[model samples]
Target chain A: MIPVTIEQMSMRFGAVKVLHDVNLTVQAGECFGLIGESGSGKSTVLRCASLLQDGWRGRAMIGDTSVRDMSVAQRCRSLQMVFQDPYGSLHPRHSVRTVLSEPLKIHAIGDAPDRMRAALRDVGLPAEFLDRYPHQMSGGQRQRVAIARALILDPKVVFLDEPTSALDVSVQAEILNLLMRLRSEKGFTYIMVSHDLAVVDHMCERFAVMQHGRIVEVLDRDAITGAGAKTSYARELIGASLAYENAL
Target chain B: MDPILTVRDLSVHYPGAPVCAVKSVSFTLGRERLGIVGESGSGKSTVGRALMRLLPDAKLSAQTLTFEGVDLLAASERQMLRLRGARMSMILQDPKYSLNPIRRCGEQVAEGVRTHTRCSKKQARDKALAMLKAVQIRNPERVYDLYPHEISGGMGQRIMIAMMLLTDPDMVIADEPTSALDVTVRLQVLSILDDLVRRRGIGLIMISHDLNLVRNFCDRVLIMYDGRVVESIAAGQLDQAQHPYTRGLLAAQPRIGGGRGPLPVLKRDPAWSQPMEIPV
Candidate 1:
């Protein structure tokens, strides 16, 4: 397990500034959360850190090494991302074998067959799922395959961007539990971004609430569950979530 | 004090499909908010579409499906079209897919007014602007001209709500209306909807997958499983729901500061899928 850090990260798209001086430190094996409304640049933070997005004015560090200094292959081996939509994230044409084996093949890793089988097994899918296409699997199963592919490379840190948002509550519960079990079993650090405060409060140790491209408040589980948040925006969010009667 | 809508023994069967998508679903809606919730393919949205007569290919069979005392099942296509968007309307899930891509926001909202009522273009535009303002859009004039792509997701959803509420329909079926929106934005939209539902005294059927959203927003809740209503309970009393399915759904949710251990997965019982003994 390794710590991930972002320093003064700022990003812009044309005239619109999407992220603003976002500084965060996630200690080793910590499951940190980023919460906010839509367009709050939560996903942008993940993209910037995961190297999917560049040209942002900031530095991202994973462990002792700077992210910018690492090669594409090196970054893949260190950290991976699981997207929100299981339907769209997985390639429709690719079989489970291809999806799992591609990363290993790209990194020139040996033992593709055994590794692919083990990856599927890790996510609670049977070995027979390796031959199935994305179309053949259910939404929850597809998400598990996506999670398996992310862990196939055995990345130390995993970026989960609204992983359970698209799923049903029952399926969401199962996925969340699977994620927690995997984290504890493998000792992998997680950075999850979700709009559901309940999910964040359940999974995260500490979380940052973002608004207007800025981190408005950083809160712990106690702040979420105990005395409530300090900022009005955070409080308003909490109140709104608690019940519709409390909504402004 | 008549109910706005009454549904009895509604079933939907797709052609060549072995089983019906919706089976023997029944409910009655007064001038109150009713939430229909379940997992994907549980047929919550199917129930909504069957009520609207939107599913053309699917064979819909209902013993009694009436809205505002009009028989929805027996109504002719032309008659149903007139009743739709005037007395009853449906708010779709995604504004991105629902809103007209090529049309301006104001024009789309105005089109609904013109379609349902005899109004001049100027009158429709004025009413559309008024509706947009009611939805809490900051600058109706500025947003009026903006296309669907130009507006944000929250703004787009609000605009969609404005369009749906433009005709002052008696009953509105919002199917996952706020699922596409952010949490804060979702509550804002729901409050706007809540205000309209109370002030206008219109019945609302909110179809969603989120239990917390339904628990807080709706007065009553129906838990559907595999094309059947497994349990129907009051929103506030969801905690003490009777059915195993209802209890499973309630327990499955990860409450903020509730539990630290791995969440309990729903162990589905075969009996939950069997026909329920209809409550009086």
Candidate 2:
């Protein structure tokens, strides 16, 4: 069954259209990727699908229910998003315990502390870190806390926007491994948006390439890994990525 | 050929820090591209700054630091000022923050030329325009009058390059030069730098965290871990690096055809933090 779907989604801001007729769908337990450069409207699609932005024209369905028809609480329970910069995404003044438990408290879920501990453990962080603030943690540790917060609600679908772009390469690898492990263990669908072709190829099975607010091509793992993209823009992006690899 | 720059036992100590930010690091450079690859806090940027004497607050010491037979460690402020843009210059990461917000882009470039050489206003302006063209900026005349905020990030970076190379320095130290650029534009910027360096025989010190970029663009690579040079190898010989940190960094990156699997995280060893002998 399809867990997430977007049909002819469009967004405009002050006479400028950022997203035009974008469509996407993800099966249960699948990881779909959106790849593009800056100003490519990939983030707009995620925003509209997650119902974070209103006034977008289209149908975004999570299972059988449309996003627009869902209540705030229902949407909160169904979808979550992890932003690009963990440093800015997390609350600076809040402790890890408070940050994790706020979501459960808002949803009126019981055993908030236990669920918070479980979430921390799920992201491979120690329980003792619960008392520390965001400033006290390292970049990788802060990112782990961000991931823990996103998964605390146990949502059916999660949107990751350039999750590791701000991290060092070593820390990025650790985070990527953690994400892959959690997805397999929990069986949740993911829609990852990134500008890096190699990272998308690593984490996603099927991916779409966007350019100038339009979807230029949708490719499978084999096609992307083989650099067999059909469009000239996709080929150019791939070529640019490969040029660095073969720089010697 | 003799090296253009040489250093021995270079160290930098911040006032309140417990340990030296850059430990007894030493290297030599000729008229070729050399890369320093390291993670944040590994002191890669500090190395570049130490060469240029830009870290005023830090206590810098070296057994020997020489550039073109001149002692940089003993040079006075006034002498160093004359040598900065006239002989060597540094390129920072972002042009947006480096450029003056209120000044015209062409005037900034011409200012560097006028300060370094005896030239009339028209001559400096002409030289600035030619330098902008050399960096491959389309419509140089129109861009010269615009403010830094008026140009795109890529164009701003090109303008920064034009300004830095206006005096025709003998060496350049670029600290994460392309980190702010997109992939397509990054190639163009790098090629511009590459061409200028090749044609002018200017030594370049490229400091960045991207291992692949360093391996592809540089003739030699220095791998830094925890404020120490863990490994130094030729670009073609990067795969044969003996240090565990270098090997781990290479393995951590996700390749295109690499199938799904958990990337191996680097296991930090306390002994690796101690200084080691650098192999030639």
The C-alpha local distance difference test score for the whole of candidate 2 amounts to 0.89
Please provide TM-scores computed only on chain A for all of the candidate models, following their numbering. 0.97, 0.97
Local accuracy of candidate 2 as per-residue lDDT tens digits, A25-95: 88888999998887889988998888778888989999899988999988888888989999999999999
True C-alpha contacts between chains kept, each model in order:
0.79, 0.67
- Top DockQ hit: 2
CA lDDT, candidate 1, residue B248: 85
Q: Which window of 10 residues has the lowest lDDT sum in candidate 1 chain A? A: A239-248
For each predicted model, how many residue pairs clash, with residues at least 3 apart or on different chains?
0, 0
Q: List candidate 1 stretches off by more than 4 Å.
A: A227-232, A243-248
* lDDT for each residue of candidate 2 in B1-280, tens digit (9 for 90 to 100): 7898998889999899999999999999999999999998899999999899999999999998999988999999898899898889988899889999999999998999899899999999999999999999988899999999898888888888888888888889999998888787888898998898888999999999999888878999999988889898998899998999999999988887686799889888999898789965
lDDT of 1 by residue, B100-144 (tens): 999999999999999988889999999999999999999999999
Q: What TM-score would chain B receive for each of the candidates shown?
A: 0.98, 0.98
lDDT of each: 0.90, 0.89
Assess the local accuracy of residue B56 in candidate 1 as a C-alpha lDDT between 0 and 100.
92
